[model samples]
Target chain A: MNEQMTQKPYVIGLDLGGTNSVFGIVDARGDIKATTAIKTGGHTTPESYVDACMEVLLPVIEQVGGLDKIKAMGIGAPNGNYYNGTIEFAPNLPWAHDTVVPLAQMFSERLGGIPVGLTNDANAAAMGEMVYGVARGMKDFIVITLGTGVGSGIVVNGQVVYGHDGFAGELGHVTMVRGAEGRLCGCGRTGCLETYCSATGVARTARELLQNTDRPSLLRELDTESITSLDVSIAAEKGDELAKEIYDFTGKMLGEACADFAAFSSPEAFIFFGGMTKAGELIMKPIREAYEAHVMKPFRGKAQFLVSGLDGASAAVLGASAIGWELK
Target chain B: MNEQMTQKPYVIGLDLGGTNSVFGIVDARGDIKATTAIKTGGHTTPESYVDACMEVLLPVIEQVGGLDKIKAMGIGAPNGNYYNGTIEFAPNLPWAHDTVVPLAQMFSERLGGIPVGLTNDANAAAMGEMVYGVARGMKDFIVITLGTGVGSGIVVNGQVVYGHDGFAGELGHVTMVRGAEGRLCGCGRTGCLETYCSATGVARTARELLQNTDRPSLLRELDTESITSLDVSIAAEKGDELAKEIYDFTGKMLGEACADFAAFSSPEAFIFFGGMTKAGELIMKPIREAYEAHVMKPFRGKAQFLVSGLDGASAAVLGASAIGWELK
Candidate 1:
């Protein structure tokens, strides 16, 4: 067989994060051949970001058989909206204004009208999971990213529920408690689900334990100032009772959060992704137990909680590419 | 202005409640011209229940041209699934076990194979609102029915979010509070959204107040057994502080629930229905204030909270008929 005939054609996938931009040349089968990274610079202008994205994707396209075989470019960023072809007010990515035009439009402008498409990184991960991961055969499930903050990518009836303004499926900001003394959230509120259950949430809980409660664990071995969610996970793996309790606590909150989400969406399962989800069963057991205990009876046995099978970095690129694949 | 030409084509709408069943013939624009009601017969047998529903709808439908001109029969039931054409395990209507198709088919056989579509009352209410009420011009909003128990139907990007098992949008049973105390829900859970914010929820709050706190109000003047949700609303209107507090508390919880839902579905507004929603500004003010305070900044000034214009009896038929409109 001729190597060139057997080889699959490539598309460019862009991952636009808060600080850096990651781009890759990927084939239909999700094989990443050429990759590049660039700083997003500051809130200078949308033109600068567009220039930066083109500069990064063009080189990768050139490296992998020039621009002709690069069928399309798929861009995935935080707050990306597929409907209006823009990203609306992402706090983390300090862009100059509220909405940014289709990263697809920018790609086509540079590449002489090649096809382009866009979606959020979280949503892209969901598409990636559908195309190439554990949820490959499933139509209903939630992809939860336990990153800097908790993010949800909901899939029901084989499509994402991007609501009226393309800002649907935000499950992290649900209220766990309401009165005073509920912890302050990053969004300047009290008792947000992300305030208690995400990695930053776990670290905050550990800090609170050191400051208020007298729990014995390896977590207390370090100064409260330096304790990390990783230390808590490590201690839990070593059979530290307090660490186990902490994980159980985190899992319990997440379980209840998943239950609430289950009530509204009635998904088949919830797939976990991002950093803190690495704790695995230590965090899963409590979540499952509480979820069953608290969920509506009909929804009790319907949803499963599991970790994602896609590599974090590769998943976003593949997810973005899936958008291009869908459109193409 | 002859009533003949403008007397739009009527479709038979059947509303199956927990205790009673009502049937009405509705014109194209949701005007209910004729209606009839019957007591729901004994429980624990599909034979009796199906007979009751058939008896309820058959006569009223016959009054309007013998079901020939009736485009379709739309039934608003509890736990009805639009996908499999079944109603599975409704708590209020417990005896209905996989009885949707048999009943619809039975009716269809009698009516010359006219289409019969069955869906849950909440979802039907959503259709009613979209087709006839406050949401008539909008494609995205959540319709919350604040009755004996809270119920919700969600619309996103011009479609409903029916989950993998056809049980999505059970918004009433979500665990809005983490670990709340008090009476258990019909589903054997504690702290459901309905447990705290429904008409029954308001009564629970009033009783708790009568037991726990010492404050002076017209509530004290009323007989304990005779106190009702209406008395509470009236008392609050008459400058009674305790009644005002009860409404304020319910409104607060409701607002928080809205903010949480906003994070999940990002609807443009919420349309309220059922008897309890008549509390009007007593409920609307607090919900709006809290939702504005708690929702994500981007979604902050985007969604509205409004009253349902659909009559209580007509809600069922209009909601179910909307599905036919959606499918057509």
Candidate 2:
């Protein structure tokens, strides 16, 4: 084991996104030794996609010493199934949208039969936290990614909960508002947590606050149709009341959702990730306050609320890399 | 190992409830060879409680052929913690209400230092289902006990979720109704699922239905304050419209809650246990309908809704006994 660890000191990580597929060769300490990228939709088929990925991935692998020096490969993608090592009907991936793509097996077959694991990006982020980020020593915690849509990776008893169908931890779709008053979600559901707590949800709160009342704020200066979460954060940083209220609303709903999540798993911590977390204590404070106010009495002061520890720019690659260490 | 199994062919199960503490000597196939009971609050202290328990429990041990025949002991009780083998501040237990009682260790010391296991009653019920009932051969499922209070035992990857603090799986306390209009819960919260779905909650619903409208029904003939869930069930069985509507309302809420639960763990099946299940298809049908209607598209029609396969009279004892087989 010691000899093998010394011989193969790195693993290949692929952050497979809608627009770009970033590949990285990483060591045990999470340092990205070599990195490369390819346009994700450039290929029209799964085989062609693997062909393009290998074209760029090979140079990076070679830069870090070759196939023998790499222990495994791990891919993080939308609709990835860890149980099957396949990408199943991912809507944003043109090559994988209508079918199950055996991307992990394809990569392993091309790379001298090295082990490869694949899972959804959110679960990858959780593995990253457990292996190298804020959740390193924690066995039970939830990672909530407040990105384009709300995504969750739930860890219980030191293992990610894959459920019976390998499709557990869909906390984003849990209902917040249960009736006709709820906003429509991308999942074709009404009143999902994603509809109220995602980055888009924050922007929607901004739009609603600006439109619903005559209260004066800096957010009114931006084009209502194109306002983004970053715009809301900047305005809040400048001490705009409406902008601050937007974060309060978003954070409050998130806290309530976390409280409900507590009833399910009673995690020790809730680690926030993605663009909304950049709001810092601006968002976290309200979340903590609301969580304490809404959570059951026994769980009131038990959980720690934290932001992701990984650097923003390379977090995805690191998250994808972390899975490689868990392949066995 | 086979010889040990043959020599110790029985295990002791304790179903410790508020009113009574029932003990049973059980075999591997869930057959009960001997059983006995004592009033749970008969003694004033934990030590004395165990002393009284031993007085009744020893006879059953002798009836099963002697201490050598017993492999282990398992206890199913309120507020039981699997990690520490303690019952932490269980409100219904007079001797344990204000302190953490190390009940499993106490029992182990008395049982000739045999291996012992303890868990919350709902979790024990889940273990029972997995080991010898409907969930046999299944790796993931949720067991919901709808007695006077709604309790849950969640199974993921074939293990009970203990979480970081050993207090996970309090699904009854998850917020179902979000605002002031929601009913008050015993957990000092408003709008908990237990406030609307338990047997008491069903009775409360029946009372409200009786008082809210002048729609004459069989329920009005009885004293409104004295109405029980059994009364509602009997009325529903006799074709009472108001009684049937009460069940529909309760089942619909349960189904909606199950829908939200699906977004969390995505269990392969949800097994319902306890008094409320006697309504059978009247409740289960609406629960299934509401779950499919409210769950995300990917999860629709995927999970099974099941009733406990164990006989109602002995299910609790069997559930407790099943935990004995799991001692490491």
Predicted model with the maximum TM-score = 2
Give chain A TM for each model in order. 0.91, 0.97
Candidate 1 structure quality by residue, lDDT tens digits, A95-206? 6346565556766788878788777888887877776677878888899888778888888777777778887877888778777978898778888888988888898888
TM-score of chain B of 1: 0.88
Cα lDDT of model 2 by residue, A1-328, tens digit: 5656576789888999999999989899898999999999968899999999888888878888888899998898999888899999999888899999999999999999999999888998998899889999999999999999999999998888888888888999999998999999999989999998898998898888888899999988999989999999999999999899889988899999999999989999999989889899889999999999999997889999999998888888889999999887
- Model 2 preserves the real interface contacts to a fraction of 0.83
Q: Which stretches of candidate 2 lie over 4 Å from their true place?
A: A1-7, B1-7
lDDT of 1 by residue, B110-181 (tens): 667777777788988888888778887787799998988899998876667778877788888877665556
Model 2: per-residue Cα lDDT over B228-252, one tens digit each: 9999999999999999998999999
Give me the chain B TM-score of candidate 2: 0.97
Candidate 2, residue A8: how far the Cα is off, in Å: 2.9
lDDT of each structure?
A: 0.78, 0.91
